[model samples]
Target: MFMTTDVTDLAAVRAEHVRHIATTLRDVRGPLIPILHAVQEDLGHVDQADVPVIADVLNLSVAEVHGVVTFYRDFRRAPGGRTTVRVCQAEACQAVGAEALGEHAKRRTGVGFGATTSDGAVTLDEVFCLGNCALGPAVQVGDRLHGRVTPARLDALLGEAR
Candidate 1:
């Protein structure tokens, strides 16, 4: 789940963490994405406090780091819940009622796409594809893939996740 900290504490910790991460990966060619990914992997999301530290270490502008973070859908700016629920929204899945399924998932989870539940139990996301086209309306819950997910099935999954 996204971490909640006092603003001052968060800034202090984020700077140290971001600096170490950037320093470790600075020698690599085009280390931007890898460094950001490392930060996200460690911290769950890339905090705004991280951007300036990362930029300074890499000798780049804060805008550059911010741009990359914003451009990548995989990079979360805020913390996600304990479980991530991704529903495929690709053309193949959509052809099989994925849209309806997506809506159902959102309503059932009480959050729209890219949102985590207040209880920090689940995060709902819309994905382009799960590479399970044959099984339309595919969904990936955490690391497990399931296909042909009906609204009832989605509810069951959410129940299980909770």
Candidate 2:
């Protein structure tokens, strides 16, 4: 049900949205995080073009805004797929074949970590932990978490995602 914006109009629209969000939330204490979150919530990702607009509204330098965006793993620099798949790469998960699972996912999805599939159906990502150590090799698809995932299980999950 997600629709993409035309490339030609994307920048202008993105700037407008970022400016509005920053302006609305400017008065909030420690407003940067909330403004960034709101921008991402509405625009799917924080475009580079948005950095200046946010900085201008918050009375911050472009570097300050850009630094925050890049520092947080939660913020996407570009649009992601409709579904996000996060595989835990923490010690617990890696101890139990999570690395192999992650590799399989990359090969199957034809995209590396933080990259969306060509068709925009899925985005593959790696996470440090999912707090399911008892159940290592955890994979989060969209909002649902699955533990003890195997290659076949991951394939099935990706199929469902697409």
Candidate 3:
């Protein structure tokens, strides 16, 4: 069976999680990044409502916490898909047809970079490098990295993700 939480109840629960994370890590040196990372790890993304709670714990302004969250691409402002598909776009990968593969992925997924699929199956992202230059045209599906991927291969991968 499926259960639905009221929006306000969800918000309250998220706030409590954020507050707990912030308070737990506030004493560490340069706590903001760790706190943010922990929040994202535990709750998917850093909700806008989390900023003030974190700021208050760390004795900073909401603007300060918000700045850290917004400045980093690694930090997602909203929930992403269950699977993250990252295509390397560095010079090496680009030299080996990454651009075309990326285009194909966008067309197939019907979502642009930084956006998740409507069904929340996959999120497509472009990364500068995955450190697999020797095998250019690398694509990372979640934590696993693949190299020398063709469009057909990518389709297979997406099919698995779906």
**Candidate 1, 39-99: lDDT as tens digits:** 9888889988789899999999999999999999999988999899999999999999999
- Write candidate 2's Cα lDDT for 20-87 as tens digits: 99999999899999998999889889988899999999889999999999999999988899999999
lDDT for each residue of candidate 3 in 67-112, tens digit (9 for 90 to 100): 9999999899899999999999889999999999999999999999
Pairs of residues clashing in candidate 3 = none
Q: Report clashes for each candidate as comma-separated counts.
A: 1, 0, 0
lDDT of 3: 0.93
- lDDT, each prediction: 0.92, 0.93, 0.93
Q: RMSD for each model, in Å, please? A: 4.0, 3.9, 2.2
Residue 145, model 1: Cα distance from true site in angstroms: 2.2
Q: Which stretches of candidate 3 lie over 4 Å from their true place?
A: 1-5
Preferred candidate (lDDT higher): 1 or 2: 2
TM-score: model 2 vs. ground truth: 0.88
Candidate 1 Cα outliers beyond 4 Å, as residue runs = 1-10
lDDT of 1: 0.92
Question: Which residue pairs show collisions in model 2?
Answer: none
TM-score of each: 0.89, 0.88, 0.93
Error of 3 at 98 (Å): 0.8
